[model samples]
Target: MTTQTQPIQAYSLPTPNGQKVHVMLEELGVPWVYHRIDIGKGEQFAPDFLAISPNNKIPAIVDPEGPGGEPISIFESGAILKYLGLKFGQLYPTDPRQQVKVDEWLFWQVGGFGPMLGQNNHFTLYAPEKIPYAIKRYGEETLRLFRVLNTQLEGRDYIAGDYSIADIASIGWAQSWERYGATRAEHPNVIAWIERLNARPAVARGLAFGKAS
Candidate 1:
């Protein structure tokens, strides 16, 4: 007997992390219902949402047809991308070595690139009083990370192998390079990759969500 899968219930905002899942779902053509959690209004701290996302973050999902046919709630953007990829048999490689390549870049974004860039953004834009030290510190780190990514994309269209979750994980954060005090001129390969990903209809549609309609 075949068990039916239910539409994924996604609670998210339009931030970079949220966009990763949204774009992946769009690219995979997975059935999902999007619930916009307004972080500014503290909706993420609500009892219901907290139960699903213990970390009180956006981009959480409840997959009713999870492993063993049990409903499962997953938090963190990277985990969500991997789960969807594995379930849909798309956007992720079946080969062991190829999977490692994708996983490395994905983890790099989660651990190093995203945090550095986020700190740069906070100091540059949202921080009420800019400490020169903090700004310079994060800004330089962000640029260094950009250079690493640019080198990685020297001849490849995507980060790991093909257009996998690794690219999906990084694109949203890379899109905010301006806020991180980086420029396209310094990272031509990254710019080209961004354009390539942006050209996809699914990516465009995913980006359009949560925008004023």
Candidate 2:
């Protein structure tokens, strides 16, 4: 570790899923060094990375300076965003009702968008061989999730009326879906939303941090 007087130690890749936390840290203006965990080569399944996250997923972190000097390690991308937002009380609303509104959308991405699009990526792109049933199944499911987001975003600049963790979780998957054959242009409002998100220099940097992006 190149010593820094910062609290966060992030293990991640450059993909949208991993970049979500990086974007959060940049948006929060917190100093942290990123230790890249390349899932492309199965580095996430290694013993070292497995120690922190048994599930072998990207975008995990450990904060040595967590509350009361307790070292905190966390996994699951959405949970990480939720923890950071509410713990810092910055990206999430303080008002209870507004916060729940954000929570609902955030949870939607965790439960719906990520999984659906991930399956689409598998069936449409990564599967060893495409099975018609799997392709149709995931493709339809992915499109359905997109329409839900498009309708929800009908009049909103950001999810929950402001740029919150809900936006983080949703935008991460949105970018992935676009990469997996879903054109943003098909959903005008979603295209506008992506442009708005890309306009952020921090988001751009965090995204570009991964050489592949």
Candidate 3:
């Protein structure tokens, strides 16, 4: 009989970036422990947290025994989601073409949508003081990203085959853009997609930190 791997211990927060792992774990229906690493006050920079996530980012995890029983620690929210989805064979496709489609959307979030909107939040709302040019630059770019998403999602329900890694990767961040004063109304498709994602019971629980006591 094949041996089972040791479960991972997750270190995370409720932020969109942090929630990727949370949602993926929920989707995977795995048993794990949560270590809430609060980045608001720089808790992630703590040496111990850094060990699991060298970048000191939330949404990192340590698999007690990975592959050949070696401890596996990883950062990067997108990578984490892909790993879990592929391992579980639940939220991602094993077929090459479908897998690539899922991966494309996942990477889009990490490189395009997430960063652009994050900057939009910074200059448009989070900056100590607003600079018109900065706000305009990021805000327009954020909308453009949304438009790209809207176009891609126009005839699709989920980003890839059924509800795969694409949906899991995008959900968390889409829910929080408004907190940064980033609006989605203009991108009607994105708005509809966000509603659908958060509507999932697993996603709802993940957003609330999953069975908090």
By lDDT, who's the top model here? 1
- What is the TM-score ranking, best to worst? 1, 2, 3
lDDT of 2 by residue, 87-145 (tens): 66778888999989999998888888888888888788788997999988888888877
lDDT of 1 by residue, 69-162 (tens): 8899999999999988988788999999999999999999999888888888889888999899999999889899999999999999999969
Please, what are the lDDT tens digits per residue for candidate 3 over residues 1-213? 223346679888777787788877876777778888767779988999888788777789887766666778888898788767756667878789888888898899899888888788788767999899998888788767767777887877777658877887778767765654445666777778888888888888877784363
lDDT of each: 0.89, 0.80, 0.77
Compare candidates 2 and 3 on TM-score and give the better one.
Answer: 2
Ranking by lDDT: 1, 2, 3
What CA RMSD would you report for each candidate?
1.9, 3.3, 2.7
- The C-alpha stretches of model 1 lying farther than 4 A from their native spots are 1-5
Model 1 pairs whose backbones collide: none
Worst window of 10 by summed lDDT in candidate 1: 1-10
Where is model 3 more than 4 Å wrong at Cα?
1-6, 176-185, 210-213
Give per-residue lDDT, candidate 1, residue 188: 90
